[model samples]
Target: MTQPASTRRLAVITGASSGIGEAFARAYAKQGVDLCLVARRLDRLEALALELAQQHGIEAFAVQADLSKPDATDRIVTALAEQARSCDILINNAGYSLPQTFLATKAQQQTDFVAVLVTSVVSLTHALLPGMVQRGYGRIINVASMVAFSSGAAGHTLYPAAKSFVVKMTQSLAAEVADKGVLVTAICPGQTESDFAKANGTDQLVAKSNLYKQTAEDVVAIAMSANEAGREVVVPGWPNKLAVAFMKILPDSWTAALIRPQAKKFALPDPTA
Candidate 1:
């Protein structure tokens, strides 16, 4: 792997071993940006880094850490400090969904979900923001989901709620940092052909949906462009955008009634089965 040019900007991406994070890595590398790739899978991260480095002729470093752990942010901070790296862009894309209903899920799994989806995002952003502010330039993309705007599913109760927090937080942070040459955006993509379903053991449920699906590359393209253009929230596909818009006009009771029947189809598989 070639050394990155000192003058090139650096992007730190989480959940970068696969899916949308991997897409972001490819996009950024193509643009000649150096990358710091983080994920729990060290082998995958290293392979991705090597491929991006060789293919794009840019530097790519792999940092393996599980975002759900309390010390995850600290590990990232230390890695950056040791490498004398300061992020020009940060993509908080590490996450997983739980298909089981809140009550059915283990207590520890629920807490870990919160740690990965909420606490880590907040801490990592806070850790990186001071440096961005000092540099007077930064970009952030929080990979939220289309579920943020609607609560249709019965299981995975916290998924939509947690994503809503990300959307709102991104909007609020964008307002504060926009004037300072920093852009913060929430990328709310609908069902995309990523490891999302497989990771959460929802492949069967996802396969039953008639909704349109997108490629991770396509979704990340929309996200990265939206971040660059300073959009607070970027919903990738037209179907997703329209769904969210439609949901906005419907009352909670109406939507809930509509979703009740569908909930059976979307229900998490019994673990014991």
Candidate 2:
């Protein structure tokens, strides 16, 4: 049987089937927080929910929805209402990058990317934040990336723009809810050990690189700690922190000149090829 929402804290984690989202689910479950795991992969989500619930003795359930759909947020909200649960913590972590140039990909694909990376975030947050604010307690963690600070890159053109939006949105929301006991944070992680590369078909390229990579667990741990401490933005690891620092210190033109060539390697091959 499920417990009343007032008695136990419930956290809604998007993209909770794997990677950083899964890490967050496990971390919060260990702390006795009931979980509503959101992901498009029903099998993985169900398996994870069952494992966590059994291991931690917490109420855990999976909600399968593709965030690219505009109605996805509404469905999640409705599910929570059906369960008589209100979100105490929300993790807006669902995202992916298109590895092609703007002209190389279909316009529909671009819109879908925006839907998942930007619109879903804003919609979900908007829906759940009211309940959180009214209860005078909430935690919102928006997973931006270290690229959020970059001026522009050749491939994954929209990724940085979307992440930048998340960072700015987090800051503004944090300011507004500072006195309301709701904590909003944007966690900016660099290259992480996750399926992100594989999902975008860059696994080989990423694996060949010698760049420092943080594990999903490490990223989640830092993000949780930072949110609890009322931090508005955090870069998880020292290497990522240093990188972000340089991006901020260097002139935009200089950074763009340095980043473009490197980023081009990850762009998708020409369709005509």
Candidate 3:
């Protein structure tokens, strides 16, 4: 891999254990960017850090933390502070999914959804943005889902709900900080092939994923490029863009109805739903 533009430049990525987060780590490393990797799995993180440093010859610092927990952001801040650190780019890629209907979902699991998706993303961004703002140049990327569009599926409500918050929050934050040269971006990807199925309990659809699946690396490429281009929100893939547009054009009732069955297909049994 060619060295990135500046050896001094470093990026922080959440959810770096595997899947989408790992893809982002590899992509950033390819650009010669040093990395601060955060995730729950220490072993997985260490492996990735080693691979990145060895393959791309960039520094890699692994910090293991469950991003869904309240202390996750604090942990990241401490890691950076301890290393005399600050990131040139921040990627809020940590998230969780529950594959059941709202009514059938577990209460604690539901809370986990909010913790990882909404709370973690917000707290991490809040904690990390000050330095970026002061420095007058930085990149902040938030990973969202195309389901965030009004086209939410039946059983996957909380996931989209959290991603919706991410999308709106990124847009608003982008508006606030863009003038300072700090870019805030929300990337919404649709039906990308990922380990999300197994982790989130959607493994049932694994065989059918290829119908609309996207490789994790491909999604990361578009997202990172869009951030550099100052795009606040980027829905990768033409199909994803069309889906977003359809969500806007279709009537709420009709859209909701259409989304219901799809949600059911991937849903975890929710008691309250």
Tens digit per residue, CA lDDT, model 2, 117-162? 9999999999999999999999999999999999887679799999
Candidate 3: C-alpha lDDT: 0.85
* lDDT digits (tens) for residues 1-273 of candidate 3: 954344477889998888889999999999898899998889999999998999998889899898767788899999988777787899999876777676676688788789988898888888888888898889999999887886567676677788899999998999999999899889999877667888876687666544477889999999989999999999999988987898889997888887776656666566663
Full-model lDDT, candidate 2: 0.92
* Residue runs of model 1 more than 4 Å from their true location after superposition: 1-5, 270-273
Top lDDT: which candidate number? 2
Q: Give the TM-score of candidate 2.
A: 0.97
* Models ranked on lDDT: 2, 1, 3
Among the numbered candidates, top TM-score falls to 2
> Using Cα atoms with residue i matched to residue i, what is each candidate's TM-score against the true structure?
0.95, 0.97, 0.93
How many clashes would you count in candidate 1? 0
Q: Mind giving the per-residue lDDT tens digits that candidate 1 earns over 91-165?
A: 999998888877788899999999999999999999999899999999999999988888557677788899999
lDDT measured at residue 145 in model 3 versus the true structure, 0 to 100: 84
Worst ten in a row by lDDT for model 3: 2-11
Better of 2 and 3 by TM-score: 2
Cα lDDT computed for each candidate against the true fold: 0.90, 0.92, 0.85
